[model samples]
Target: MSVFETGQTVVRRDVHRSGRVWSEQALRVVADTSEVLVAACVHGAEARWPALYAKARDDGDRSVRTEAFEAMAAGEWELAAAVWQETDLLLWKPPATWFSVNAFFVPEGDGRRLRNWYVNFEHPAHRTEAGFDTFDLTVDLVVTPDLTRWEWKDEDDYAHVRRLGIVSDTEPGPWTPPATRCWR
Candidate 1:
């Protein structure tokens, strides 16, 4: 097991099961231990995202995101250069867990304020030389910064990906859907 030092730069790569890179972002390590890796990215951090995902974010068009899911179903998509904007992100990933918890901070008066807590349901982290790799399973949980309200996001995409065989019974681990875990 490789250990990362605080303030060191590392690359987080989202990998498709087909042995292809889906997206990549640069993050700075905040804390590292045998249990979890904590990393963060501030505004203007460089990232590469799926073009259609980028379009959806830029244009606020939901259909573009649907198209991205379709492209993922087909295992073909283009990458676009993007920058982290408007917020600072801190991510906590336990190497053996099926999810990562993220906190997004937006600029407030003189500093930043917690915007929300985002839990991304995904494969457990696979440590790499650069940073770590994981596959996003599409569904996510969004919670208020104060932990009062929470919502599930992208159930439609999760269903779509499951139907397209992007996520199936044979990925890895004893992971189950967030819905099953949280509500049941």
Candidate 2:
């Protein structure tokens, strides 16, 4: 009878925790895109590093913790640091490299409507912070469409989205992401 199936499931907590979920998606995109786009992505996702850095600073790995502290202390953001001030979450001073976010939004009729958006983030892989060489990315999606766009005033990658707000821009744009049928 179906090899004695148990009608139950087993889940690994680590899969969702430890940044594995977001990290894996980030890595896959890094592999699929051209070299030029990668840099652009880093630019787009710069705003979220504050939260990530905070998370990294408290990392369980002794080496990672050390690296996080050093990164946060240097305070060298190439872009504006205003958002971090608003969020009140700081982790690293300045990182050698960084990654940014790209979110998908569906368009509405009249070419004007609100849509949900998400942000992705990543810190470069460094020996002190887990000993690797790649983008450690994470994605942050808005739960609702009314969510207004926010960022460190001068540090935005998109002139349109920053001014119109994510939903406003997303509604009347080339992007027309299809509805998800299932979780990837």
Candidate 3:
């Protein structure tokens, strides 16, 4: 098992089961241990995403985003260069876990403050030379910074992906929501 040093630049790749990359983002290693890898990216970090996905972000059209998923389902898409915008991101990934916890920070008066906590249910991390790889299952949980208010994100999309055979019924095991977990 290889370990990444703190402050090292690593590329996180979202790979499809067919061995194609869906997206790639650069992150700086925050912490690395046998249990998990922690990484962070500030606004302006480099990223490459499916063109349709980038369109969805720029247009704010839900239908366009849905179209992106459709593209993914067909395994036909193009990558567009993009930059992480407006938020600082901290990602925590446990190699064998089926999910990852993410924290997004937005600028406040002089510094930044936690905007929200996001939990992405996905395949476990696979170590790579650049950084790591994982497949996003499309479903996620978004929690308020205080962890008081939370909601499921992209459930309809999850269903759509499942119907398109992007995710298998047995891919994820029984899991608990963040609300039910002990954060403190």
Number of the top-ranking candidate, with lDDT as the measure: 3
Pairs in steric clash, model 3: none
Residue-level lDDT of model 3, residues 1-184, one tens digit each, is 7899999999999999889999999999999999889999999999999999999999888898888888988889999999999999999998899999999999999999999999999888999989999988888888899888878777777777878988887896544334333333
Sorted on lDDT, highest at the top, how do the candidates line up? 3, 1, 2
Residue ranges of candidate 3 with Cα displaced over 4 Å: 175-184
lDDT of 3 at 82: 99
lDDT digits (tens) for residues 32-98 of candidate 2: 1112222112112323233344454445444443343233334322212212121111112123435
Q: Predict model 1's lDDT versus the native.
A: 0.88
TM-score of each prediction: 0.90, 0.21, 0.92
Q: In model 1, what lDDT does residue 164 have? A: 83
Better of 1 and 2 by lDDT: 1
Clashes of each: 0, 8, 0
Q: Model 1 residue 32 lDDT?
A: 99
Model 3 scores a C-alpha lDDT of 0.89
lDDT of 1 by residue, 1-184 (tens): 9999999999998999888888999999999998889999999999999999999999999889988988987988999999989889999999888899999999999999999999988888899999999989888888888898877778777877888888886755433445432421
- lDDT over C-alpha atoms for residue 128 of model 3: 90
Lowest summed-lDDT stretch of 10 residues in model 3?
175-184
Mark the regions of model 1 whose C-alpha exceeds 4 Å error after superposition: 170-184
